[model samples]
Target: MGVAYSVGEVDHLYTFFVQWSPNIYRKRNNKSSSEKDMATKKTVSNSKASKKWEIITVKDSKRRLSLCSSVDSEAEEYQEEDDALPVLSDHSQLLDDHHLLKLAAHMPPRTRGYRWHLVYSTAIHGSSLKTLYRNMAGLDSPVLLVIKDVQKKVFGAFSSDPFKVSKYCYGTGETFLFSFNPDFQQYRWSGENSYFVSGNLESLQIGGGGDGFALWLDADLYHGASFSCPTFKNAPLSTHEDFIIQDVEVWTVQS
Candidate 1:
């Protein structure tokens, strides 16, 4: 009922089937290897893209920070330029141009841009305390008192209120004392005393405490004294504690 085959024919058919199976397996293996290679390439490309973005982000951040610092530096430079030298009404006998520049740099911010007007000068008005007081009358603005001693040591006081005869000490903490013994020195309120300034019929005082005065001027405006005082914590303003006044000037800052 079945057709008979020779052994050679059966062996030949088996050999053919085996060879064909191997070829199909090789093709499948090659396709899988190709897919794996493509996947690895895609991963590598994605990694490269991520690193590029990261580097760009870091660079952008640094650029922004540098820009901000540059802006701040420019703003600071502009502010310094705005604070120029102040204008004086006339030449000063006690203060030269260099001294005036240094003193102007230390004045209150509110008074920096205004003009300095000479109200009283011993060289012009003569040496008299009464005359000085009369010239300061009705002036509600700040005043600068510059004194040059016989030793040529220069010192001064910045008074918030005009000098006048007062029973009690009167002046704000804005009052300060300064000295220029070849170099400029400023003494601000020490917060140790409220005796910033006081005036009497006989004398005028800038600061007081510890049984002494920072600056004292006699009625004649010809003699003066300076000592370490609690109000400004300043050393003796003059070369000596008591010195003869060679020159005196009072300047008022005006609008």
Candidate 2:
């Protein structure tokens, strides 16, 4: 079935679409043939096909969810019993799966809903730490923060609490900054979200705050500093731009 639009709407759409378009329009039976060539360059990309699905069944006397991905009308599991997980070329896809699995591990066994799902992703929210924190306020769930450096390396951490302001702002060592590739490095929480890299040691990290979580990279302001508490303050900086705030997602139990 084709979409049905009113004659007035069709005309309005046509005129509005090509107003600033630079492409040459050709007439074929009174219709421009260039509509099919739209969206040539990708603004956003995802490795997993949109046609994803999940199902739960009784197996081994335990409930387990079977995730299915579509390829040429053929369905395949994300994690196969006999085969290892496929390495996705797209960072977004790889990150998405990692985030989901990280959250799911803390949730119910094969039941779903104990961990966080993507409520706020910087990829869609844009690159403002303040704005990112502002959008994530008041969600009652543990937060996970991830960042992709200009080095093209991906890393982040998991917080045990929701992003918010407390009467007291201090570190509880409940956050861990971890790497997703090359080296799986995870900094043990120092029992406080506040700390200093100390003595010319460069740092890259993230954490929760009075407002929300901070996603930053190598910042000069905190370069070789000393502090009394654990904190995630340095902004993300890369060789070119600051740091890429790759993603921020909340993990919550489904009530």
Candidate 3:
């Protein structure tokens, strides 16, 4: 026969069982429960980190796009600005026809003896013909004389020195006459606006024994002029019948 345990011993055993049960349960749950908790925490942290990274990437991308857009806009604006201005060639094309026609009218009338004529005119405000002549004195075949007529209200000689005559002529008036020897070999040119008339004085070159002489006339003397190598009879002591003119060439230097 076996003896039964006392009540105190039984109570103690039940208490120990209760405590042991909890320890065993804790040991069993530790592997999966602790791992699950760690996974959840890692997931939450990773999610937060990923969201932060995405925000940064998005902001950086937007910033870069904005910068690229601004640059493109600036370039377009510059192109538009450039397009709005007139080109140099276009401005030249738009010159006043009246001015050109007037210059054409100033051309010395065609004569039987003259070969060619080139004419130019410029306002006195910018450059002086005399200065231009001085600059062009060393070029090949320079103008023999440059007649200057200052149409301005001022009355003063353009140049008083006679030595300066070799290059240019200056005067205070409305019209001036220029005579040039095409035979010159060296002339250096300067200035902006001028008129040139070129023709061969074939008869003038022959020297004497001609029906008429070449004459340069200022028709309006004050505002306009005409040059012609007219044919006239050759007679002694006659003001009009002295020499004949022929064959002129006018050209600009390219060098």
- Please name the candidate that would achieve the greatest lDDT relative to the true structure: 1
Q: What is the TM-score of each candidate against the true structure?
A: 0.68, 0.39, 0.18
Question: Which of candidates 1 and 3 reaches a greater TM-score?
Answer: 1
Q: CA lDDT of each candidate? A: 0.89, 0.42, 0.31
Task: Please provide, for model 2 over 159-222, each residue's C-alpha lDDT reduced to its tens digit, 9 standing for 90 to 100.
Answer: 5554443444323455555555553444555544453221111333344443423443333322
- Higher-ranked by lDDT: 2 or 3: 2
Q: What's the lDDT for candidate 2? A: 0.42
Q: Estimate, for each residue in 141-236, the C-alpha lDDT of model 1 and write its tens digit.
A: 999999999899899999988999999999898889999998999999999989988898799998887778999999999989999988888989
Higher-TM-score candidate of 2 and 3: 2
Instruction: Report residue 243 deviation for candidate 3 (angstroms).
Output: 25
Judged by lDDT relative to the true structure, which candidate is superior, 1 or 3? 1
> Which parts of model 3 have CA positions greater than 4 angstroms off?
1-128, 141-222, 231-251
Cand. 1 TM to true fold: 0.68
Q: lDDT score, residue 145, model 3?
A: 24
